[model samples]
Target: MDQKLPTIKEIAKRLNISVSTVSRALHNHPRIGLRTKMQVQKLAEELHYEPNTLAISFKQKKWFTIGVILPELNEQFFSQAISGIEDVATAQNYTVLIGQSHDSMERERMLVEAFRKHRVDGIVLSMAKNTDDYQHLEVLDKYNIPLVYFDRIPKGGQALSVSSNIRSGAEQAVRYLLEKGHKRIALLKGPDSLIASAQRQEGYTSALKQHGLQLDPDLIKEIDLSPEGTRAALTQLLALPQRPTAILCFNDYVCFDAIQAARQAKIRINKDISFVSFANLPICNFLDVPPLASVEQHPYRQGQLAAEMLLDIVEKRKTITDIKPVILDTELRIF
Candidate 1:
């Protein structure tokens, strides 16, 4: 039979020290002298002793891990956000665990609950489009767990958040189209339930009013942030009595699909119709008909800010009163 591994008790007995003393010395407690700690550590190393993570966690009352919940990870936007999160987390000596909601409310709730069960130090969330009720997030409050929302945030405020100025970005896109000699412009908005979509629509409407362009209710189309939805929305927009000369899309994926639908319908890009999309994805370059313009929401910066906020909360480096919402600015990426 294989020899049983030596326990902390065995080490204490062999060292002629009390079990409590040995445990403190092995953990490098401040109360334990350096000589005793060195002796215990050297003996433990020679004995091939491994500290139990459970015991360590019990003592520290922390897992030193963070949970990141995202709507989708397949998109370049979220991928870049994760990159920023990883950078900050690695530097701070914290581990990051990821969970994807797949834009489903049920999945989002499950992920949040699982993270709570795991007792992560904090959570960074980019809410799903279908997420309506935020009572699940109130669980974090109930548990005294810190949560920082990023990109897409929950409705109703006082929640900590780091995001781009979505309304300003949308307004800029709409204003650009109006300046391009396009009178009848259309908008491809995300689902209405999404806070980001609502904010963007508000900006779009504001821009239209600013330019003396009547808000055409028929030109505003709301669809899911999917290629299929974009295709369907574009089909409907093109079939309208007065087809728009330019369309503002929700994001790069929608723009890709809209371009495809336009081509299939024999509509020329940059001449017959133009488009401006948000989230300047890499795939935009590979598209047969690229967007006329795109918005740079600085997703990487948003990620960095969100991660920094979470770490600050964990380390108690700052108080909630000192914490302010970080709203990064956007720039128009003209094609």
Candidate 2:
């Protein structure tokens, strides 16, 4: 029969010291004295003893884990983002806990409270589309849990954040259309409550004004970020008295629906109507007709930066004041 592994109690008995002293020595507690710590560590190594993480965490009142709250994990962009987050967390020897809010404020609030109850060291969050109240986020602040927002950030929050420059991306997309001789451009925007949508709208208007063009409210349509919504919005925009020669969609998914709607309306892409959008999805290449241009937002880098920021706060290596909003640049991939 194989010999059973020696426990901390066995080691204590062998050394004729109390279990508490052995545990403290294993942890390298300064109060335990260097000589005693060295002796206990040496003996524990000889016995092939492994300390339980749960016990150590309980003793130190730390979970050494961070929570990630996202609207949904089904998209490829977020999948890549999660991969980047895992890369940083693994390097830092920390664990990650994930929660999907599915774009619901109630779900998001519940997840935040759950993370608080679990006593996670920090959090990385991408706010839900319908989230208007941030009082639940205050719970994290009250508990001294640092938070780093990424991608879809809150309008006003005490948390640090990392995100792509959406305004620049939107401007680039609009500029590409204008350069292609596309006048009377239409914008299929996301919900008004979303910060990302607001930034994109600002960029669109700024680009138009720079070109000495009057902003036309009729050419802009705000819709939910979904395929059905995109389809309906495109129909409405096309049915206007003066239809736009080109359209800039809120995202790749909206672009897909816009293209489909144009084809259904017997409009030739890049000829009768040009299209540009954010999110350079790989599937765009396989389409029968692709948008004239798309924006690369670097979701992977956003995730990595957000994770690093959270870990820094957790390790006490930096504070929120020391961290600034990290905005990565975007590029217009013109087809």
TM-score of each: 0.88, 0.88
The residue-level lDDT of candidate 1 at 5 comes to 80
Residue-pair clashes per candidate, as listed?
A: 0, 0
Q: List the residue pairs that clash in candidate 1.
A: none
- Error (Å) of candidate 1 at residue 172 is 1.7
In terms of TM-score, how similar is model 2 to the real structure?
A: 0.88
Global lDDT of each candidate: 0.89, 0.87
Residues 1-335 of candidate 2: C-alpha lDDT, one tens digit per residue: 99986889989998899999999998778899888898899999999998777887898767889899998898767777888898999899889999999989999999999998998888899888888888998668789998899988888534598888889998888887887787799998898878889989999999998888999999999988877888888888888888899988888878888888788889898788888898787778888788888899888898999999988878879877898888889999876
Best by lDDT: 1
Weakest ten-residue segment in model 2 by summed lDDT: 154-163
Per-residue C-alpha lDDT of model 1 across residues 248-327, encoded as one tens digit per residue:
99888888888888888999987899999999877777766689889998888889899999999888999777898888
Instruction: Supply the global lDDT for candidate 2.
Output: 0.87
